[model samples]
Target: MTAPAAPEVLRHVDALAEVVGRQHVLVGEQVPARHVQDLWGSDRKGVASVVVCPGTPAEVARVLRLCAEHRQPVVVQGGMTGLVSGGVPGPEEVVLSTERLDSIGEIDPAIATVTAGAGVTLADLQDEAARHGLVVPIDLASKGSATIGGCVATNAGGVNVVGYGMTRQHVRSLQVALADGRLLELSTPLVKDNAGFDLKQLFIGSEGTLGVVTAATLALRQAPRTRTGVFCAVADVAGALELLTAIRAQLPGMLTAFEVVWADAYAVLDGLDLRLPLPMGYPVYVLAEVQGGRPEADSEALLACLASIEHVLLDSAVADTAAELAVFWQARERIPSEILRMQPLFGFDVSVSARDLQDCLERMRAELTERWPQVKLLVFGHLGDDNVHIAVVTGEQTRKRKAEVEHIVYGCVSRSSGSISAEHGIGFEKRPYLGYTRSPEEMELMRSLKALLDPAGILNRGRVLTWGNETDPA
Candidate 1:
């Protein structure tokens, strides 16, 4: 049970309700748990002063204005599916939910763009785009629940990043609500607008620090007539990279995704009693996809490319049918859930150069295995874009030993000149490690920009850039 809000807090809540509606304002116990918890399943839960749902950008601006005037810290939330605690509110902070901003505009086939509100899920937008023979290039495991606003905020990169690109490349323009309640229309839908600074890029991966994204015009691509994928068993990461090089050189632009899964991670399917595409003894598994106009030609090209590099691969399975392709991907996607079944686990999303990835993983694995002999490390990720996802379970107290694990993992990444956060932003979870990937001067510039746009530090306070002497919440 929660206590009642202070009179001052109630007054501000009432004012915010006026902008949206009383029904849209949820207080104390009325606020759902999902609003305060992140997908990482951390024990630390946020306490929101109030949750306000605004339907329009105008209402969002008004709400921001009121919060700014009152010096109230505001946390912007969209779908709340973030792995990091970027959307999670702090104690007594105002949570501005974008769930009501769910409107999807008409798809412009001429320009191959679609404008959608912040609350629209990625899966919804993808389906709507498919209706018009177009496709949203960005695809994530959380697409069914992750909003476009969240995607733009994180500059999300998914399986198809090798084919298309990150969400940053797909977003053409953005409508942002600043901390001071000003609605800034950042860009036009023009294909090549080079007249001035492209301000929308700032907020794309800003992680809601500078401003709250209300809507965006996303660039879409024509739907491919045929898609074919192959699941291959590689000897090791180096072999997988070699196979990737061969595919790229042979298949050219037809390659859509190149994902790698470690043998330990793939073995999770056996624990789940799920069907396995191949035996589990291989060191690594690769899931590669290619899209083209002709189904037979695309399939033949992919098979031929694999055959050319058959020495590098231990075994392989081809998914020419939609059902087979889903089954292959299902094995890849289910790795996280099966690994997470352990009592205590720490997940990481980092990026390293293709040349350094194998070495970096080897060093990390050696150190972790030496320190904790009983540790389980499940590793997989987008090989094409240099991103890797690692789940570690050491059969020890994870909460207390998290820093040690992070040190081992991030130290290797830093030494390799890789990003601590590949796609996920520097939320509360990774705030301490921002220095590993960014230099003092680079971080200072980020702070300067944050101060300039959000002088009051009211929007997503203590995220990305920490506040003075502020520490992580218990």
Candidate 2:
């Protein structure tokens, strides 16, 4: 899409300023660098012409209406914590940031749900829920910076997803603003709402291409009174799966997480100055956690369960205290920071059947090793949910090599019938490989829906699925 002329862009900014007070609108140099590119840099990186902060859903709609009238493309931004660059704006596009919309509404303990604005941070919501003796099931490492709207938009799944589910499952209702400025209040706090089509789901995980998620009513549960964590060394993926099966059969709903870490890559943690819980590293590591009401009883039950699976585990460590658990978890959580220090890295979140995960990883490793023997591969993730995250470090790599590595990795994922993206949405980075995972009919249906909801295509243009690879004015 051609950018509007300088005069036309200035006029559009002036109109937006009128809708959402001039103080809330920032143009040109006033726009911050964070608004241009997401946490993971985008290839289509360009500074937005203006950054408009709307304090309310009404103000958001008003700004959308003005942009629609001006035929100006808009890129809706949340907390700017997304790794897929879904919230990144184009050079001429206007940025509608929800940061000013930060508000957490009442939490109804009776219904076990809470209403929150799209801009509310996940950490804020989690803290609020804790005060009420409730919990928001969705969680991630970036909870402090990631907004609830961004989580819903990506349908984010984190470590807790094994026990709970994705952000979509916890979302009871959504308030969305359409491309043409029309508001859609979909679903409700009611647990059993089967009135007709669940239109709210269409916007969830759509990455804001269809509409702007203004607010959400998320389901909550009573916070677990007792949390028990165990870290075990397994022989391989098969042993990891076996231990997972044993834990599930013994504890049932108690299993909260089953994180798998490949030894060779995880060995880097030893080099870090941080504390290491285990003295020796095995071939593989699995961190399993269980939560329940009775602290003492739950701890005993978890220990007994782990003992039963001794055959599958090479070594084990148990943590009931917060400090002990932190030491055990520090290794996995600190990986991203350590990997980034290496520079020129490619990160992937992929999934396959539990049985097929081992084969898929092996094939990808073989291919990558053959092509780039010097490359470093670190693999770990919430394996109980069939999700695996891989990090590749090309110590001495070029910009062009990134694509070559992606081709090798994604090719194995496709061959194994695995999803190229497990939690992260198909932003500009993954748009090309989308065809590798989705069928032709599925792709066509997605495009049809995009066309139907956003006929003018003013919202998040060139994101997810770019229509016909064509550029056109909204």
Using TM-score as the measure, which candidate wins? Answer: 1
For each candidate in turn, the TM-score is 0.97, 0.96
> Candidate 2 at 241: error in angstroms?
0.8
lDDT of 2 by residue, 316-402 (tens): 889979788878778778866666666677888888888898888888888888877787788889998989888887666555677
Candidate 2 lDDT trough over 10 residues, lowest sum: 1-10
Alpha-carbon runs more than 4 Å astray in model 1: 1-8, 471-474
List residue ranges in candidate 2 displaced over 4 A.
Answer: 1-8, 42-44, 468-474
TM-score of 1: 0.97
Candidate 2 TM-score to native? 0.96
CA displacement after TM-score superposition, residue 427 of candidate 1 (Å): 0.6
Q: What does the lDDT read for residue 474 in candidate 2?
A: 13
Q: What is the C-alpha RMSD of each candidate to the true structure, in Å?
A: 1.7, 2.8
lDDT, residue 81, candidate 1: 76
What alpha-carbon RMSD in Å does predicted model 1 have with respect to the real structure? 1.7
Q: How large an RMSD does model 2 have?
A: 2.8
